[model samples]
Target: MAHSRLQNINNLTTIDAKGAGIYIHIPFCKQACHYCDFHFSTSLKKKDEMIAAIITEIGMRKNELEGQVIQTIYFGGGTPSVLSNQEIQHIITAVYNNFTVIDNPEITLEANPDDLSNKRIAALSNTPINRLSIGIQSFFEEDLKLMNRAHNAKEAEDCIAAAVKHFDNISIDLIYGIPNMSNQRWLQNVAKALQFGVPHISSYALTVEPKTALYTFVKKGIITAPSDEAAQEQFLLLVDELEANGFIHYELSNFGKQGYFSQNNTAYWLGKKYLGIGPSAHSYNGTTRSWNVANNMLYLKSIQEGKLPSEQETLTLSDRYNEYIMTGLRTIWGVAVARVQQDFGQLYYDYLIAQLQPFLDNGLLSFKDGIITTTRKGKFLSDGIASDLFFLR
Candidate 1:
């Protein structure tokens, strides 16, 4: 059955990802990473309540999608693997009962190396979750310790070996640009990931976000932050190595073998509608964007009282255009010229074209086939270049 599904993977995965996707955020983790700022609690005291609240939110927001077929169901968070298989399935069952899910939806669960025990992997294989996105930030003791991850180097390599036995559609995340990490170490990390034969790899440069432990340490001169030069060199090396290994650089921080690009993220990048349930999850339905409150206890109380604690913002024309530039520049699909003209207006399109000349001359961006895409030299600088092209309204 697994082999057959792998063969027919594209049908199950999001093709063009036009349909809406579902995002369920799990906000409990065994431990906190030093450089992280995502909303999550180390304590699992309210995990049961949190799951119930997520299910309630799904039921309440079912109508928000207006019967759009759900193509993808993503379990992302502080380590979705912290929940039992039954807990994961309960949320999925609620989705089916309240929402319109198409046949063979692409369901993904984000897990950490420490949580993916052999027994856990086998148990998860029995659930409806078809894909695993492992957070193997690094397969080195020094790096893992630097980030304060729960799993050590051996567990990182071991979990992938175990997970691939049950899942062919697997993606593992690797982080580069950690303080004191050499290019040699970065190359070895990527090489170790490739040795596992995983189909997808997501890599990111470590940054010190404010309020994170790393930030405080850096502010106090207890730790040095990753350098921009080091990050750029490592990122380029990552792209070169992964692409040479037959992986497609589908997005700025994502690479996948053919037919393995992340459907949930693809839907998001293409501006398709999605409903994000659970605390701190964000939702978009064409015109307006909304996000749930980041407070777990408050979210639980509000949902139990039949109210959703979320904030909504209606998108303006300028808001939509700027978003397009940012997401498009980071993706393999460049900003479509005709889309800018038809969706925004000639004025917006002209501004985009006007901004293109400078990047074009400097070989940072290229315009071809009525589309604008970043050049190799500009890939690392994609975010900065996209900001420069933004219509600051």
Candidate 2:
């Protein structure tokens, strides 16, 4: 019975009927992590203005997702936990006023360890926000210092202990492939997270993005570049450990227990429409994709003038096909051969099969029931394999 239930969670493909999602980007952080490249500011001076602009953007785009019910409301960041409870409530109220929401939408707040004190978690528990995605990247002092995370190792454990008391739906972020993280250390990290009993875990291989401090450190040989081979080994270890503990490897970078999959991200992988409100947030319908300007000042000025500070592009058939291949292969919902034929016609379907043949023959991908999914051996390489299957014109 337990096995069957887990299987059902792993096979989930569709989202709620007529459902969409909303993502609100809070662009302020207390400090910068060495490896982060996402748009964010370290200043809090403009936070009030930023919040007001975001609420206004939500109102202005109210009709954009007409007739669809919002299934998820995600507060992503520069660290959304920095907002006061009242501020968070105000933003959520704006969402309710502007859009039609489901009876109990999965509202998530991306938070940092330093900000989630016992008092703060209690306050957040009273709000409509029902889920927490905490940034507890590593529970080691060295790793925390290396990454320049604002919180210490003690704070990492402290926050989780406090959080589970108030929120049952919690997910924590972990990084596995830091330059000096050994396989044993990585295993220890996984062990520590399991001890916390978090139902969902999102782990990623740390890559130094261009222009980040990590990049500069690597360029100057102050820190060794992360090894791809090491990352692959650690990833496989994570899959084995997490799955042994009843966690489903639902996506390439995410693991969740039954009933704990991230609704917001699952909707995204299934190609559902969602509106993004704030600086550097992105929005997508089935046909086009748009993103707000990354500059906070520009976003504030435009929103103040009652204009959307964003740009959009329509997706061509080839673009759509490529995206499905990319997102589909990364999750349990493999790319459907029938979906390709029905949506893009015979030519695309044929081209996809031809491109996929080599990986299939090499045991990196498996095709059964007309669905093409990455095999366990191919999981780490899914992105590269997906690129090989792109329907380039």
Q: TM-scores of all models?
A: 0.97, 0.97
Q: RMSD in Å for candidate 1, one decimal? A: 1.8
lDDT of every predicted structure (CA atoms)? 0.90, 0.91
Tens-place lDDT per residue, model 1, 224-284, is 8789999999999999999999998988999989888888888888889999999999999
* Model 1 / residue 354 / CA error / Å: 0.7
Worst 10 residues of 1 by lDDT: 1-10
Runs in model 2 lying further than 4 Å from the true structure: 1-14
> What is the per-residue lDDT of model 2 for residues 278-321, given as tens digits with 9 covering 90 to 100?
99999998999999999999999999999999999999999999
